[model samples]
Target chain A: MLSCEQATRLTSERQERSLTLRENTELKMHLFICSGCREFGRQMDALRSLIRRQPGDKPPED
Target chain B: MIPDSDIADLRRDMLAFARLQISDPHLAEDAVQEALAGALKNAAAFARKASLKTWVFAILRNKIADLLRSKYREPVTTTDPDCKHCAPADDQYFDDNGHWQQDTQPRSWGDTHWLADNADFWKVFDACLNDLPAEQARVFMMREFIELTGPEICATLELSSSNLHVLLHRARLRLRACLSGQWFGTEESA
Candidate 1:
């Protein structure tokens, strides 16, 4: 079992697309069993949604 | 003496990309103009090593950096104290029943209709993006908002894949932490 710190780091890495499959699986497994980490993941998702909504100066076209 | 059509295209493209990096519409416009001027003056140096879009974007990034540096000597911070509720506690996922629980699954989390649906939420959201570390924020904006690919970002920022990944990871994590504080009541002090 990965430590909470290791799981946290891996989860962040996975979110960034920097983690290897092995690392991702380890983190996913850890999350499956750990409520805190699972919550962290959910929060991470919520955060992504919020950031996407942030209005920038760019026009509608790109 | 650049052609008007090319200049128009460049203006449109640069404004779009600049908006990703800069929240201020006026500043983004100014930065795009400055970048176009620099690119035209330095046209002789263009070797076609990268796409014209990438080359232009690199120049725009530099201009944006300069503007940000001048406007805020210190890093940007959140003005909303209420925005602090989004950060997660170490124990937040657990239920009162002592069972491991998740309020929402990650897949369903992509449904951003709720956030996009609210104007007030966006006010705090934009502030959170500004609060991110500058480089990471730049990368995230380029990748996510501007739809730049990894290789394109690597070429533009001159970052290796590993370095880019790390920078992006840090940026996303920080943004997530910041937004969570605002939207989800996760505690900004965390």
Candidate 2:
């Protein structure tokens, strides 16, 4: 199983590129048992959501 | 037909947007003015397929891109800030060889308490972003707000893939920590 730090690295990495099958499998397995890294992933998603809704999120007119 | 009110709104929003990317108030205003003027010149060509806001923003994005390219015309040495937020220091979040630290693990911020819509939330958001190192923030905005891809960012910024990745990671880490402290500090309310 990947350490929390390594798992987190892969988590951030996935944002820029898709993980390979082996990497994906390892991360998933790690997350299954690791709540901290899981939470870290959730935080990353929350951050993205917040970023997308930033001042320049969409082009207004909604 | 573009309404006068809409143009005014666009100018205000674009100014705020440009200010985030470019530190110079004068240059930021210049970018907005130029974008607005370009839109005016192309008024007849606008097909209205997209919202006027979207169309104008697209033009502004191009203008910002041009400005960035010009400013970085030299063989760019990207300023990769030494992140104070990454590993070793982050050991509390994990254990030796990399297992989660369990007791120090993060909790899910499932409901971010309307931060996605609150105007004040954006203020904090912008402040947090502005707190990052200039170059890190620049790369971040281009990737996140401007939605530029990795290759495009690398080509434009003269960064290697690893450099971009690390810079991006640190940027994300810093932003997350700031928001979690300022916005999500103690809120678990649904």
Candidate 3:
């Protein structure tokens, strides 16, 4: 089982790399039972969405 | 075929991206103009597979690179190893067993979409972004707002994946903590 710290790190790591099956399973299992990290993940996603919708700036076509 | 209006739009987007990379407004404008000029010069070589916007943006990315290289050629002082976010944290959330500490567990910030309706939210956001240790802010903007690929950012900034991810992680954590305080209801003063 991944620790809260490790799971949090995985949250940001998802931005740069896709987790492997084992890594994904650990993260999902930890998140399923951990409300704080789950809430933290929700906030992170919401933050990204808001940052994406920031006016006058579209996602650079990459 | 290049339309003058299309050039104008390209310049606008290019300028926006350049402004994030370069501090001086004049320098940003010059970079954008120089990029457009280069694109126009190579107009015949354009494969037409990429959108005009993408083509122009790729050109502008190079232009920004050129300006950074020429205008600031010295060893970079901005990406300090010991900077706040770049350094390892003193207190981590997990104990020896890698489980959560009650005190360090993250707290929730309820529906934060009010940020869209409130223009001032951006003001707070900008301030918070600026408050981040300089290196972290640069990495965050390049990776997120400026939309550089991980490899591209690594090449431009000379960071390995692990180093870059650390900077990005710190940036997100710092920014989220700031928003949770100033924008959400968790501010210490509140």
Candidate 4:
């Protein structure tokens, strides 16, 4: 089982790149049982959207 | 024709972003000015595939790069091996067994959609972003704000792919902690 520490790291990294199949499975299995890591993942998604929506100055298009 | 107010806003945004990369305010101002000028000169050739803002920022990015190269001898600082601020904060949340420390477990943030229009919330968000260490902030902005690809960032900053990933991950984790503690987990302070 992936530790919360490892799970959270993958959670953060999921923002930057596609995880390997093993990583994705491991993260999914851990998050299924770990509310803390699940909440951590949701927060990561929230932060991404919030930062992107920041008013006044918009980031450049990809 | 883009209104003067819109141009002024873009200039302000460019200057703010430039100042983060270049220490001198005057130099940052000059770079933004030159970028706007260049964008105007080539306005005819601006293919509409990208938003005008994106095109403008692309020009500004190159302008800042030139200035950094000429003045600092490197367009962007590469990773520092022993930099104290660049160290990861993972230990703060996890114990020796790699489980989350009891006090540091993630908390539910409740509804977040309402925050989209909350100006005060943005203030806290900006503060958290600004509080990031310099290198982490740069990479985070490059990846998240500037929308650069991982490979593009590695090329631009001369970072290994692994290093870029680590910096970006660290930045996200820190920002998550800051936002949760300051806004989501507590009653509105702003």
| Chain A vs native chain A, TM-score per candidate | 0.75, 0.85, 0.82, 0.86
TM-score of 3: 0.65
lDDT, candidates in the order shown: 0.58, 0.70, 0.70, 0.73
**Greater-TM-score candidate between 3 and 4:** 4
Those runs of model 3 whose alpha carbons end farther than 4 Å from true positions after fitting are A56-62, B1-20, B23-29, B32-85, B90-104, B187-190
| Model 4 chain B: worst 10 consecutive residues (lDDT sum) | B43-52
> On residues B1-190, what C-alpha lDDT tens digit does candidate 3 reach at each position?
7667867776776776688788889989887887677667766666452345556666676667666656644543355354443666423445777665565456777777766546588779878898888778888877765566776666666666777888887777778667766777553421
Q: True interface contacts reproduced by each model, as a fraction?
A: 0.14, 0.54, 0.54, 0.54
DockQ of each: 0.17, 0.40, 0.36, 0.40
Clashing pairs in 4: none
Superposition error at B159 for model 2 (Å): 0.9
- Give candidate 4's chain B TM-score: 0.63
- Give per-residue CA lDDT, model 2, range B30-126, as digits (tens): 9899878866665656645234555677678777777765663455465445533223243344467656444445666668746655667777878
Higher lDDT: candidate 2 or 4?
4
Q: Give the per-residue lDDT of model 4 (tens digit) for A1-62.
A: 99998898788778777999999999999999999889888888876786566433332332
TM-score for candidate 2, residues paired by index = 0.67
Which candidate achieves the best TM-score against the true structure? 4
lDDT of 1 by residue, B1-190 (tens): 3467876877886786677666789888888887777666665565442344445666676566556445634422323333222233334323554333343212222355566546576567668778876677777777665555676666555566566666665565556556555665554331
Residue A36, candidate 2: C-alpha displacement in angstroms: 2.1
Runs off by more than 4 Å, candidate 1: A15-19, A47-62, B1-112, B188-190
User: Which tens-of-lDDT digit does each residue in A1-62 have in candidate 2?
Assistant: 78777787788889999999999999999999987678778888877776665332233221
